[model samples]
Target: MNRFTTMRILRNIVLLLTVLTNIGCDQISKDMVRKHISYYEHISVVRHHFTLTNVENTGAFLSLGNEWPSPVREILLVVLPIIALIAGLAVILFKQGLSALFRLGASCVIGGGIGNIIDRAVRGSVTDFLHLKFGIFQTGIFNLADVSIMVGTFLVMYSFYKDRNPSPKLPA
Candidate 1:
């Protein structure tokens, strides 16, 4: 294969690996939580700073649309995200001329998105169980999928910032 072909193949492999790894991590942890934790019961992980509390969220982030009428919530939470995740995967897999960081970020986002989408499709809700608080900085219970999203968001943001303000290359 030519140099260009080899590089493209490598990129594809790397992207696929990143995507699968994140998805696997999220799904496995969620499965463990589902099997072990009981609803509304929590075990403190850090002496009041962090805990695991089983919750099945039928809505979006922080249970945003949970109170909405069923049909509306279903369409908004289930159908729309499926469409969005498909579009995102298309971008990550098909779009060319993207940087390594861009592909990594996109893969991470898409991976976690698919993991949660699977839960919503099969279970009718997403599982969440990690809670944290540092003094007054509290957070809604979340899972590895949420953490993946946050990491992916930061990576994407960093990619944009770096692209906009690239550093000068030193001479050899």
Candidate 2:
């Protein structure tokens, strides 16, 4: 195969791998939480720092806007991810000037979003286990998919920052 063909094939494979890895990690962590922890039960892994607390979030991040009716919630949670995935794929295909870091970040975000959407569609909730706490401060329970999304977002932000033009030099 020609070099271009080979590179295209490799990129496709990498994208597939990223999606599969995100899905697999999310599913496996959920399974582990289901098997090991009863719902609402908290097991402290570190004193006032971290814990495994099983939770099922029916709405989006930190259970925000959860008061919506079931139908609306499902549509918002599941349909939005599908739309985002399509848009992300389009950006990957057409945004030739996008850096590799941006592409990777987009892939990761899409993959994680799809994974959570799958859980919400099939189970009516997203499984969450990791919990963080310090002094009087605490973070909501999250899962592997959430971690992937956060990391992807950070990378995307970093890429954008790096690509920004430096301030024009004042005649020195």
Q: Which structure among the candidates has the greatest lDDT?
A: 1
lDDT of 2 by residue, 70-102 (tens): 888967888877887888877875556778788
lDDT of 2: 0.84
Per residue, candidate 1 scores C-alpha lDDT tens digits across 88-169 of 8778777887777887888888888888888888898999999999997999989898898889988998999999998999
Candidate 1 versus truth, CA RMSD in Å, comes to 1.5
Worst 10 residues of 2 by lDDT: 89-98
Residue pairs in candidate 1 whose N, alpha carbon or C atoms collide under 3 angstroms: none
RMSD after CA superposition, every candidate: 1.5, 3.0
Please give each candidate's TM-score.
0.93, 0.89
> Global lDDT of each model?
0.88, 0.84
Regions of candidate 2 where Cα sits further than 4 Å from its true position: 165-172
